[model samples]
Target: MSLPAPLDQIAVRRAVEAALAEDLGRAGDITSAATIPGSAAARVVIAARQPGRLAGLQLAAAAFQALDPAISFEPEVEDGARLGPGDVIARIVGPARAVLSAERTALNFLGHLSGVATETARYADLIAHTRARICCTRKTTPGLRIFEKYAVRCGGGSNHRFGLDDAILIKDNHIAVAGGIEAALRGAKASAGHLVKIEIEVDTLDQLDRVIREGADVVLLDNMPPPILREAVMRIGGRMLAEASGNVSLDTVAAIAETGVDLISVGRITHSAATLDLGLDIALG
Candidate 1:
């Protein structure tokens, strides 16, 4: 039940507030308002309906707190905790209206982030014995990249660059536009700050040779099979960080890892992970 470092409270607060706004638009929980008395209170337990790695607890708590400052959200598990079926994630007690109003928003955060974490864990665990690490790419859900990346870490996976601004990854298009790999490398090197590393993607070992000569911090071996990947790693010989991208899946990740590349970047972990099923049930006091 290890916990990752706490998410930025400011970020969590802003995201939760915005989500709550979207859900409680205009009239603001009219269903709850119409049915529940002003003084009515209720207790509930949010439980996992399937196995997963937990994440986004802070956002879940913030969702309820935004509506009712006095709401009690006693968490039974922390982010990064591996959950089992029927496990109670948290206990909530508050104004019945606030509880009902915040339920969907809270579970939305929990389920989505937990799903990302759970999927990442599946890949990470498979390649645990190998030197390679599982990494999530920029193909993340819009407006939810930070949360999803954090969830990846909670699942024992590493993160790729957070965005285009964080690092320079010269893709095939960039090379084509810049005239060639050498030209792209020259341009990126000239423009980059001292702290920034330049990474260039290459499809074939010929391009990799040019990159090795041109010099870069990391080389992305795009879509190469395990045999080619192993050869590329040998060619690089620890000169630049070796990363494999494209066509990576649970079935083939182990083979990719055994090739000795430093990172295996998978986009599906964030873009296509299924929502972990979770539900809030009103508790009888």
Candidate 2:
């Protein structure tokens, strides 16, 4: 599937470059030196060791290509496809030393990201009956936010702000520092350009009421109980979008979605997702 137009492909490529740099450092893979010769050629299959969703194929290919320009990647399965154990997701032919060098880094990107997508897809499936949609938050790996959020989309979850510049989010800190919710709301609204919509995070119904009175475009109902979230949704009454966030786990997402909120932002999707099981098996021609 094509990535969203709003996504900057250059930025994504740069991120992959940065990651490759971190792994390669000044000298390229030193470990591959003692084992594999420079002119060696090999064919490898990236296989899924367990059944789950797949994502980040192109990014992984980019990582390998960065290591060896001669590397060729043939994706047998597309991103966002559900796979079973023993499935060959990709076939790669390249310099043996370069393939060995890029193996772990490439698998690291795909495994962790595809794991997030798989986990998010499970939550999305749980809330499929509800009007609420699963969304991801800014709580991502420091530099890997784009990749993580992209994986979220692959899993059927929507993305929140990619960064602070793209949207105005007045959280509790902003309210405390700005004096009050109304003050923060007014300040954000006044300073924001016509295109910027402000979303304020509120922990209580009382705070929610105040923001509603001040006119917020979106309210992130943080850590609210199911009853309170439902009440907040009714209070807002379609005037603004109600977003349920905090403590959102697979077990609780369905209940949160049942509260009639427009969105559910889960942080754990990217922050703590386990890497999916995958491996690259070299084949002899």
Candidate 3:
């Protein structure tokens, strides 16, 4: 899918800049500085070594462009495109030293986020024939939530709240702090502004029953097994939006979706996703 028009260039720039800053902090690329001629230009192809969905090509381009304004990127595949091994996703041509310097940082963002989108796409495809929607959780890299969540959308999955401030999520901890589930849910609904939605997490059937009785806007069923989840869906009976979360993985995601919950929020799709296999190869020009 095309990135949202009015793409957050500012946020994307900040992320690319921060990554460059981290890599070039103080010392700079000492090895490239020492070995590569400053004015030399090179052509490099970003090739996928494994099959997966692509995301963040623009960010990768931005990462290189920030380092070398004269650098040019020719994208052969857009974000959300399915790819096979050895696909040339993009070509970067610029000062050889700059290309080498920016390579890791560009691929760092590209590979990691693409991996998330790819994994999310797999889950999204698995549940596509069903009504369940794939979503992500608060378990995201700190400060990278916007990009990560954007990648989720690219994978055909929806996003949960960007953070705690965006909505009132009365989790188990909140319930503890507020004394009980009822108190927490009630307080959340009562104090939340009219525009805000109140969702609560329930770890047991009893908690789900309680939330259903009180009529929560959404109920997150945490760590419930398939049987329990199915039962919870029946118990809730559309009283609220039913969400199944906690330890969701590709192996069990289909089963979880079969339980008939409305949403599945998987943390591993973000926090623990492995970077997709990608590499920059210097092409003969």
Candidate 4:
């Protein structure tokens, strides 16, 4: 698959700058300033502790550059690449104190985003043979939704609507407040622009039938079992995109995919993924 575009350079710079400021504090890296000579130079390598996919090399590079504009960060492999234990992701050469000061912030972005990518890849790989594609939900870290979603793409997964503004998603609550699916769909369709697609969540075959009859752009099959999902897809019959979600895990994902839904949306790929273990160690010549 073609790689997703790299993050906007301005966004990268701003995030790392904020992180470096927060980490530096008023006193700065006092220990490094005191112990490491200003003239001292060091080389470091970021190595993986376990096997997984890579993401956020750009942010890591930005972190170092934020501290020292002259820092040289050479990425050995791009984001979305697979990693093995002891795999050297990138090499950094710069003043010793600046390198030490930026290490944690750089690793923080790298590890969290890599975790998101790796977890997504695990789900994507399982459903690769099926017609369904893995996708991530808005259940992402508050300010890091874009980054996490980008990481999902890095793992060979697809992206859902980026925000409430991206499309009209009439959920269970919307239906309840709007009185019924038909009313909700009617209101959404009336308000939506020519380009906006409307998706609605349904939990039962009856609701799916109503949504299909009423006409929607996509149907979210919320928490339905494999059999129910299969029936829902059959009911859809190519009229609307069918998406399944709720409490999905590795053991059950393959089965869910076999049900032939168009997409499987998982929230944990961002909110609950374990951070991939990566470390910046001094490179010895």
lDDT of the candidates, in the order given:
0.94, 0.89, 0.89, 0.94
Candidate 4 local lDDT, 121-234, one digit each (tens): 999999889999999999998778888899999988999999999999999999999999999999999999999999999999999999988999999999999999999999
Native-to-model Cα distance after best TM-score fit, residue 84 in candidate 3, in Å: 0.8
Cα lDDT tens digits, model 3, 5-41, are 3238998899899999999999899999998888788
Lowest lDDT 10-residue stretch of candidate 3 = 1-10
lDDT tens readout by residue for model 1, 1-285: 256688899999999999999998998999989999999999999999999999899999999999999899999988898999999999999999999999999999999999999999999999989999899999998889999999999888988999999999999999889999989999999999999989999999999999999999999999999999999999999999999999799999999999999999999999999999999999985
Candidate 2 lDDT over 191-253, as tens digits, reads 999999899999999999899899988999999989999999999999999999998988899
> What value of lDDT does candidate 3 attain over all alpha carbons?
0.89
Q: Between the candidate structures 2 and 4, which one is better when assessed by TM-score?
A: 4
Worst 10 residues of 2 by lDDT: 1-10
lDDT score, candidate 1: 0.94
Badly placed stretches (over 4 Å) of model 3 are 1-7
Write out the backbone clash pairs for model 3: none
Better of 1 and 2 by lDDT: 1
Every model's TM-score: 0.97, 0.93, 0.93, 0.99
Summed backbone clashes in each candidate are 0, 0, 0, 0
Give the number of colliding residue pairs in candidate 2.
Answer: 0
Instruction: Between candidates 3 and 4, name the one with more favorable lDDT.
Output: 4
